[model samples]
Target chain A: MNATIKTLGLAAAVTLAAAPAMAQEKLKVGLLLTLSGPSAVLGQHARDGFQLAMKDLGGKLGGRDVEVIVVDDELKPDVAVTKVKGLIERDKVDFVVGPIFSNVAVATHKPIVDSKTFYISVNAGPSNLAGKSCNPYFFATSYQNDQNHEVLGKVAQDRGYKKVYLLAPNYQAGKDALAGFKRHYKGEIVEESYTPLNTLDFQSELAKIASMQPDAIFTFMPGGMGVNLVKQYRAAGLADRIPFLSAFTVDETNLPAQQDAAIGMLSGSNWAPNMDTPENKKFVAAFEAAYNTVPASYAMHSYDAALLIDAALKATGGMTDNKEALRAAIQKAEFKSLRGDFKFGANGFPIQDFYLVKAVKRPDGKLQTEIAEKVFDNYTDAYAKECAPTN
Target chain B: MTATLFFVQALNGLQFGLILFLIAAGLTLVFGVMDFINLAHGVQYMVGAYLVAAFSAWTGSFGWALLLALPSALVFGLLLEVLIFRHLYDRDHLDQVLATFGVILFLNQGVKFVWGAAPLSVSVPELLSGSVEIANGLLYPVYRLAIIAAGLLIAALLYVLVNHTRVGMLVRAGASNASMVSALGVNIQRLFMVVFGFGAMLAGFAGAMVAPILSVEPGMGDNILILAFVVIVIGGIGSIRGAFLAALLIGLVDTVGRSFAPNLLRLVLDPAAASQTGRAIAPMLIYIFMAAVLFFRPSGLFPVKR
Candidate 1:
């Protein structure tokens, strides 16, 4: 058994060594995301979007033949840590692009950054990374975690809502969502409730909402939880009585399942499929043609991440050896973002526009979010000032 | 909380409990009679939801979908039993666990391959689509109430089926001692198959009933599976009566505790601290209840007499 194992290991080593030498020098990218379980749709879209961008570039990034390794995080932090270590140590990827959810980002952030590898986030921009713990190697192609929720908070305040009930899955992101909402909406918070992550049933919580009859209800449920909550909220007849304001809960990832139940629901977002720009229009059309499903912000952000990498490589002339040069090029963000006017804050988070998007059923009978109104222009995150100049 | 809110919460608890009971009933019976730990039982529930969703889209009527889904779920359960599970019945518990876990992974991926990862929308039938006012200023969804009604009716049916039938007598006997039943000339293997399939259908039925309300997606059964296991363990591994009572206790504790935990804590702790601590503790309350139960009655509240 020992002799056979040794033989197999030698054969594997030869295979790994021969392929890269035979081919042109390839840029290896580790694409880590939650690709299983209920939230798998989010990661699937992100993967497809990144793949679409790669296809648009003739399967190359910055004129270099690229090899992408996709791994499923399974939305478990421990599982993510192990998988990311393999990508770093065994694969020796030049860049690590990943992580749909914030918890996984928090788990893999240190390991990827400490290895002197650039970590480009497609989604999941947790607040801590935008502040004291920010690393030069880490760059978020997505908006800061609090920005989308802050848009909803501002909308609620502008609409003159006196009291709003808030709900979110109890986790780091969930807490951040409520805090972001509270930052702008100074009206009385009628009540704040946090359900455990992935909770499907909201009957008890719905009962509480019915009794309170607050001016509006704000929530931050995503993926399957969002689908269930929207359907349940509609069934409970609260959608008609209370204004529903949210972020991520009523977006494209869930709109397909939500259908009529989610129509006219307002959500805060950085981009939507219906945003009117030639580049966005072309990207959205191509994405739908390839994937046959409307692209969510998750997909949009990931596509942008791929473009960001390509742009950085172009500036560096595809040379990945000089870490400082690559980091500087990525910080410049020299790409036409699908969302329009994208640039990085000092902390490597996006300084971009946010919108109060509303869900609508299109003429094609597909449900998606459309930009209802622009809420912020060139918005900078609250935590950016806390990021010290280290690089 | 006000009286009306308390009453509404209690109703929600009952509804949630009934769903838990439906899933736990099958799990307890299989564990008790076969002495086989089938971790893939949750996948059976997921399959049921998927089956109902598909039928609903194909037939364009939820009622017809449900009617067709029941028999289909039965066939699917029996198919799994024949294809994979029956062979493991005589194996040790650890081997059975590992094999069944593989089945769960395979089936979860299989469903995704067939249905795609995005949740399929299953609409509530028009007959039960709206909300009804239960009390002054209190409104509840008619569909949820329908679920509660259906759950109760099935519980009553299960009670009669398990207590009065000759097959049930053999099942109880088999749970006590399978070798004695075999020695008495009963085809104990066939009896095990029957018990296993019936339990799977019960779980599937629970899944079908909630398809309209829940996200009919892959791995949807995982969390509920944990809760169902807690119900069976707390109630007693084999006792139908114990499972029913314990399921209700767990459901109420989980639902009511989630809402009231912070309020109760606020009487002592500061509001922020109470809310944070409450959110942390509420999800764990059921396990705490299970632990407390095991401490008092290790074999469960209604352990089968060996």
Candidate 2:
């Protein structure tokens, strides 16, 4: 009887000793992004920004070592779902980040939410999640899909433009963008056209736009499509005559390829390479030194996501498995964002400032987007009001 | 105003069609003579563009880049032929397709590995930097005009090479009946290599020429490849003349259709519905045309064997 009691006492001691070691196990983060196809640059920039944040954090988040598993979705929603499932069921990640395009986000978000894994979207904040379907486990460090377009709409309204032509790729996000622009701008839209997603040539559309002769044109063609449109627009001599307004079209990733063609083009975003904040300045310098290129808005969002993650981790002492503690910590959002004065709305999307930027040539002969004016101050997405507080 | 717009639209259509022809010419010839389906042919166009971008950056002269890229593209084509394609010639169509699709996957990733994923731009040569007044009060880029001119020139050259020369006779005979050509004292393997190499160079030349206007990136040829297949199908397999006619037809239908479809539909449907349906129908116009042609003729408009 005394020997049995002593053995039980020894087993309890061993269990107590192993508990601390088990708590110190590395936290896993699954990064799902479209790292291939035409839009690979977007994913690459996002990854670079996220990795930069990790580097700055001394390769640790929340005082705990992190293991990041990056997977390419190839910009396909089905593939994204498969990879996200792998990340959840196979890798057993504590948190997930990214899937840059909106369609992929919509398809993959449900599983993450259902599985109760913490999700901080680096890019692609779809409206569906911001409204009735808002989940407590999901937070977006990026603006909702329509927020950037809403900034452009406000800019057009402020500028007193009487007639504007809107063009975008005919996809879910494109339609949402057009609707978002229409929501705020009360001007007479001369025409709105949605071209095929894979369209490389825009001559016919350009000719049509020229004939209509709107005061300004707003378009949302991302990736190589944007480069082709902007170049072709300049080649057609339309850029000199019409003001080109865009969202998510002109940025650091594509500006080098566009060169002089993107000059004088106006765009709206939440961040610019030249934003004058200490955190942004430091980020820009470190990013340029590391990648030899200016980080774009996508990168800025991703970097902010990493900082948010770090802040939450620190708040909870890296207790990622303690769901309630991690949730409360994430809700605090106490990170210095590259975008100044960042905070999340009730729907978990960013309520941040949006800036009107113009693509300009630097003295060094490199293309850079410079912030011209603030378009929105402390703006929350339109869908945020529709979201019932789940937290 | 309408007349000038129409003229420019027509010019745009013609330019697009000619570019399609340049890509389709090589593809159709290879398919016709070799009886092989080379899905990787599109990647050859992509390689051509990348080669021009890299060569232009290295040489700092577009003219020299073009002059140098042609032979390199030809050699690359021959190399691919000897390395992988030669082994697949005796295989069935499904096997050839599977093998070439693998090549497409390999080359697309290979380009990305070497060049990085960012889109690269090739500046227009100073000689072709500006627009020309192609019509009264109408201006078009000189580079586009140059592409159209170059494509036509190649078409004429191809006509001469395929219909006039001794080697051309062998190719035509081989296309009609490979066994008969092999029996007529012709080295069929050598003929196949020459045709394959020349076809690749043609596709590569198209890519290099358009590199300045298009964003040169990996997988760029994938879309154009599908369009080339449509062109060959409509023009009748293996017929250069057929490919040319079919390419122009598809291009005109696509450009003009996209530009006017909404307005035309607005006549019947509500404005909102018209635009939505128009946007949806524009891309399908050529495919619809291809289907209709195939339905009526059952062997395309100009099947070469017939």
Candidate 3:
């Protein structure tokens, strides 16, 4: 019986080694996003962008078929953990991706990592994982949680915008954003407001912010709440009086709903729709042509995530069934990134650029993003250095 | 502290409170009278919103859409009562809560299946499209004032029904002691149907009225329902009067706290800490108010005997 079991194990090893030769088969990638209740817009955007990337790659990845298994995290970390485990255990996906909120991402990271399944985060970069918990299996395609806000803090400090009013939805992300600003900015803060996580009414809060007459208003409302705040902010007529700076709220998803009201709003991000690179330009045009809508930042990062996976797949010579070999191949910088050449940091996050984009009304009459300033070029996140994984 | 800003926020609070009352009045009545804890009440609001959105689009008139939606919302609520809620009355609170929670899960998902996950908003008619000046340079959305006015009118009408009418008397009687009313030969099953149906329409009105302003998406009612439960507990379950006052108080406290709390705290604490503290505490103001009320008045401020 021992000899028979040993022979079966040896046969499995042989099959793993031979997986590279039979690499042209379909590769399944698990896509987990917050697909319901307040975060649907984000999930929908991610799905659209991921699907678009598949289309751009000639509807295939790494000379093989790519199948995406999408699941809704529902913005709950425990639920996200369960859903991710289901994806790995039941669906048996090759790799798990996504979770736009940092809390959910962090919650599910342990199970995926313990299982030795590769994970590529599209959004929600928690500081701890970026620092201490950083494993080779975990990679962040999106900016770290504090990185974008840190840039906004610098801008606020550089411009000497004292008495800034900060607004965010009441959640871990909101707390992190406010903390992030404090870590960088030394100026006097006039007010800070945390509305309910899914609050649609922002008039009262806006009234409060306007009353303060802060030098600038920094906010982090995402999804439908962002749309509500932007529209009501205009209705309250706070434009030009108090400059609005935000993250996640002023993007393509809410832009259509906000229309002209979104014009002149400033936001910071790692990527924008009009990023003016051959890859990004082609991606934008193709996405617009296919979906009849402009891709938001959520979509862009998710597309980059898929392409990153695809690049790793190709570099591994299409061998994904051989998990160890595929992991090693993907670890190297093989993806042609839309945002220039940036390799993964030791922590699995890419060394990437950041930009401060202005919400501009293009001459063609659509609300568009234009680069107001470049925050960083091929910059590493603050937490990356702490992530020294002992081999 | 400008008058315009103050007036707008005060009124915004008032509007917010009034809208909540419409929702809470029904919820509190159900809890107080039936002793059945229902989590699916929020879906009724969603149904009303979706109904108005669809019917308005079909008829091209907000008035007719609302008129048609009221009956539909009531019918849906009555159907839910018959299918699920009636059985829960004799069961334990835990069982009732779990069963109703399941209904919430099914209905929330069902709404998504029927209406799709995308948010739907109602269009304000041409006449009520812009703001009207309630005070100098204090232009309140005419529609909002109309909401406040309509809500108060409903509150008054509800008061009249609960106090002046024969059915309202029985409703009050049933709320205090359901067994007594049953012993008196009232058709208790039909009464359950009426109260549940009416309660749903009230929640539905809140949804339809606010749909033009708020996005009508799935589970929108759930959050407000939590606040409404707090209201019912504070005002005295089964007491429309209690719901009104508690709703207004909570509305004022939440709105005013959110507007003024940070600035108020900045006077004492460091600016950043104050801001952080303010945002964290703002949403809790109502629940705090509720807890205080519960602490002092265990049965609620207007508790019916049952």
- Write one digit per residue (lDDT tens) for candidate 2, span B1-306: 777777788888988999899889888888999999999999999999999999999999999999999999999999999999999999999999999999999999999999988899999999998987655434578999898899889989989999999999898888889888899789999999999999899889989998998899999999999999999999888888999999889889999999889889999999999988998898899999999999998777878772
What's the iRMSD of model 3?
Answer: 2.5
Q: Pick out the ten consecutive residues of candidate 1 chain B with the lowest summed lDDT.
A: B130-139
> In DockQ, how does model 1 score against the reference complex?
0.56
C-alpha RMSD over true interface residues, model 2: 1.5
Estimate the TM-score of every prediction.
0.92, 0.95, 0.86
Q: Write the per-residue lDDT of candidate 1 for residues A1-391, one digit (tens) a residue.
A: 3433454566667796664454346899999998888788899989999999999889899878899999999999999999999999999999999899889999999999999999989888888899999999999989789999999999999999998999999887888899999999999997889898888999889988888889999999988889999999988888888989999899888998999999999999899998889989999999999989899998888889889999998888777888999999999958989999899988999999999999999999999999999999999999999999874
Q: B1-306, model 3: which lDDT tens digit per residue? A: 567777778888999999989988888888877888888787788788888888898999999998999998998888888888888899999999899888878888887787666666567665776766554333456777788999999999999999999999999998899989999999987887888999999988888988777767778877887888888888988888999998998889888877777778989999778877887887788888778889999988877764
**For residues A1-391, what per-residue lDDT tens digits would candidate 3 score against the true structure?**
3433454566667797755444344578898898887567777888888988888788887766877888989989989988888988987788887878788888999999888888888887899889988887888888788888877887888899978998887787888888877776899886666777899887687666655678998898877677777766765667657888888778887776566777999988888878888999998888888877677877888898888888877776666667767767777747777776668788888788888888887677767677788977888888988998772
DockQ, candidate no. 2: 0.67
Q: Which stretches of candidate 2 lie over 4 Å from their true place?
A: A1-23, B133-138
Residue B192 Cα positional deviation in candidate 1, in Å, after optimal superposition: 1.4
**Candidate topping TM-score:** 2
Residue B276 CA displacement from its true place in model 2, Å: 2.6
User: DockQ: which candidate is best?
Assistant: 2
lDDT of 3 at A83: 87
